[model samples]
Target: MKSRHVIFPSLMIIFGALSLYFISQFAEPRFQDASVDAKFFS
Candidate 1:
């Protein structure tokens, strides 16, 4: 039971890193993103 407490956080960090890696790999980068951010800020 005590071992699981350590294992859970480690697994969570690994999975979170993997998800971010794939998202950055295939995600689109566009110039229009500045337009969206401007709208959000203003």
Candidate 2:
């Protein structure tokens, strides 16, 4: 039961990192009128 608590959050962090890396690969450049870059939001 104690291990379950640690495992879940660790898995969440790993998955979140993986997803961010995957999404960043497809990020586009900033728009002409936008102040921030597209990757910043991605």
Candidate 3:
């Protein structure tokens, strides 16, 4: 196998995980608010 093939996939996986982590962090507050609204409205 070539090094480019391995490096690209490795970088992609690392970036994917980081993006997911940041997304979850950013989304957590919205999710909390949604849940609170659900509780109050229901």
In what order do the candidates fall by TM-score, top score first? 3, 2, 1
Please give each candidate's TM-score: 0.63, 0.63, 0.67
- The weakest ten consecutive residues by lDDT in model 1 span 25-34
Among these predictions, the greatest lDDT belongs to: 3
Cα lDDT of candidate 3 equals 0.82
TM-score of 2: 0.63
Which segments of model 3 are wrong by more than 4 Å? 34-42
How would you encode candidate 3's per-residue C-alpha lDDT over 1-42 as one tens digit per residue?
699999999999999999999977787677677887546644
For each candidate, what is the lDDT? 0.75, 0.74, 0.82
Q: Give each prediction's root-mean-square deviation over alpha carbons.
A: 3.9, 4.1, 5.5
* Model 2, runs deviating above 4 Å: 29-42
Residues 1-42 of candidate 1: C-alpha lDDT, one tens digit per residue: 999999999999999999999866654453255677446545
Deviation of model 3 at 9, angstroms: 0.2
TM-score of 1: 0.63
